[model samples]
Target chain A: MGQPAPAVLLPDMSAAGEVSLESLRGKVVYVDFWASWCGPCRISFPILEQLRNELGPEGFEVLAINVDEVEADARQFLADVTVSYPVVRDANGTTPLAFGVMGMPTGYLVDRTGVVRVIHQGFRKSDGEPLRASIVELLGE
Target chain B: MKTLTSLLMAVVLCGCETVQPWERGILAKEEMQWQTNVSEAQLRNQIYASKEASSGGAGASGGGCGCN
Candidate 1:
């Protein structure tokens, strides 16, 4: 909130695709930085999917940015996990570095203006209630 | 006689190989090699960012370009 939040334009699943934080303006966005091999990341994927489906129509978006080195691995992981949100493959993890991610499964709740309101780190399934509450608050705001 | 004593010592040492579940507490200590404390996390993150192509884990603040 001090300086402007870092801007990240990440690659989308489509061959010619690219998505940017700036493009997500006017909607509440949840940007999650994660890797395929991270255990906690695997654990939280389903919860994220639920959030996306449950709140998508309400202008909520979940962007799962995979930090895997290989695009195939990222794709395979998503295939196995079956997440409903957009899975951005950061093969080089450029977006993650721009966001200063120090931990796996770190999520940024950004409001409609592209301003990050809350940062959630290393969340567990048990954290579903509190995490949902934070997302709701941002959505309401 | 000396060979028998050496064999007895070997068995005693080998018997100590098993680690009980309760003893795992010591293995789980913050001071242990696998244990991560605040400072250690910082160092490990720095190392991980530099060495690994992928990023993100748990705990810590901010982001960096070390991995990219």
Candidate 2:
């Protein structure tokens, strides 16, 4: 068994609407904590989009949680990226603190059983390979 | 005064040792001092924020501030 996912309620994606960890049960979820002003975040965003498209229908979900303090910047970033997946906003970082996120582009992959299996600290192109492999493994491929 | 000068020269000679590029393998070990310092990481985080527009690169390493 992996680490149990901590109970936390994330903010709604300002561009879309509300979403929560509890609502995403029964799927392998990749939770990415980012902001509009982080460079590594910008680079990893596309990879995340690709993962969502490639593995999404196979029960993999990407939750891009924005740590931007302002709603305007978050909205502008959404327009900038054109991301299709939900981008939740952490207006006060309550959820971020609960998740122990240390830096931008940090990712946590929780299995369908709600056990967090992988915790990635940064975004190097090298980081994505392991992440993808873990997702594929969890999805039973 | 001459003894002091000799002692100082000896210390300087001992301090002159340098590590060549290949010798850096030991320094590159994880336990070495080259690990990312928290303050330096914050400075780089600001650079990252300015260049990429994102935050939260390492867990609990950042708190929301105008710094990034």
Among the numbered candidates, top TM-score falls to 1
Summarize candidate 2's per-residue lDDT along A32-95 as a digit string, tens digits. Answer: 8877666677788888888889999999998887777566766787888887877777666666
lDDT tens string, model 1, A12-106?
87446888778888888888887765668888888888877888888899887776655676677777888667777666556766777767778
Those runs of model 1 whose alpha carbons end farther than 4 Å from true positions after fitting are: A1-3, B1-68
Per-residue lDDT of B1-68 in model 1, one digit per residue for the tens? Answer: 99999999999998776542212323434477655577887777788865654456554444556643
Q: How do all models score by TM-score?
A: 0.64, 0.63
lDDT of candidate 1 at residue A97, scale 0 to 100: 67
Model 2 TM-score, all chains together: 0.63
Q: What are the RMSDs of all candidates, in order?
A: 19.3, 17.4
Stretches of candidate 2 exceeding 4 Å from the true structure: A14-17, B1-68
Global lDDT scores for all candidate models? 0.73, 0.74
Tell me the tens digit of each residue's lDDT in model 2 across B1-68.
Answer: 99999999999899887442212323533477654586886787677665654457554355456363
